[model samples]
Target: MNGIKNAVFTDKSIRLLGKNQYTFNVESGSTRTEIKQWVELFFGVKVIAMNSHRLPIKVKGRRVRSIKGHKKHYKRMIITLQPGYSIPPLRKKRKELELKNTK
Candidate 1:
């Protein structure tokens, strides 16, 4: 990963903020603007809007073990693309989007 090309966005609050968009787990510190720029550059489509938020950290424990490990808190962002251009559903539409960001 170049790690600087800006591929993902991270914001947790976006989960309930968006009406028609989905959120992705990304770098915790990433911002909505950076995501919009990255999406625009990679997918060749215009980003209509974006929002980001931090998810509350939750305490977690190891499964079936006495040891405990804290689950790290992360951020995610919800991005809205132009109505006409959309990233197909990931489950059944992987191939169609496989080459989209290949470069």
Candidate 2:
């Protein structure tokens, strides 16, 4: 967990397909290992493989003079996990059994 646990994750972490792949709002200069560690610790999952993409910097205004600067850049990480382990459902079922103080 040395290189993992950067951020606890924000609401922007969207689920990709159905195989426990999630997208994160990462720093512009985050590396593969750094991102992998962060995701692994945060989600409590074993990270099998990790990939990233650097998005283009967005210019807010049409003319450079109009706006003082452009928007910041971002990097996205696509994480994969081993078999037999899947992420918990994003939503909870109200009808499901609720564990109470049985002890």
Candidate 3:
């Protein structure tokens, strides 16, 4: 089983696509080294570097008569791959859309 989930496709992540970096949501306890290894093994690409961010849990609503809890916290990893290796799903959909537009 894979320890890391699919790459995140948020606006920020999309912006980083051209730089050959991708983002994925990983288990909270996963370490940076583990993430790097998973990226390399799963994608069959060399991971140049990796950085992880722990998302802050947001406090919800007002103290009185409102939903009272923090949002789920998770870790996000940004992995930069070696030159010439790209995560296909990220660009694959885009290329297809472009091709459709040109037709």
- Global Cα RMSD, each model: 9.0, 8.4, 4.7
Clashes of each: 7, 2, 0
For each candidate, the alpha-carbon lDDT, in order, equals 0.50, 0.53, 0.75
Q: Distance (Å) between predicted and true CA of 17, model 2?
A: 2.9
Off by over 4 Å in 2: 1-15, 58-71, 89-103
lDDT for 6 in candidate 1 is 28
lDDT, candidate 3, equals: 0.75
Per TM-score, the best of the predicted structures is 3
Tens-place lDDT digits, model 1, residues 8-94: 322322232234354555565556667667667865667777666654553364243222554434555666667666544432233
List of clashing residue pairs for candidate 3: none
What's the best-to-worst order under lDDT? 3, 2, 1
Give the true-structure RMSD of model 3: 4.7
Q: Which regions of candidate 1 fall more than 4 Å away from where they truly are?
A: 1-20, 60-73, 89-103
Expressed as tens digits, the lDDT of each residue in 12-102 for candidate 3 is: 7766877988888988777888878877887789998888887654345334332356443458888898899997877886566556767
TM value for model 3:
0.75
User: Model 2, 33-55: lDDT tens per residue?
Assistant: 77777766766778887777654
Model 3: how far is 77 from its true place, Å? 0.5
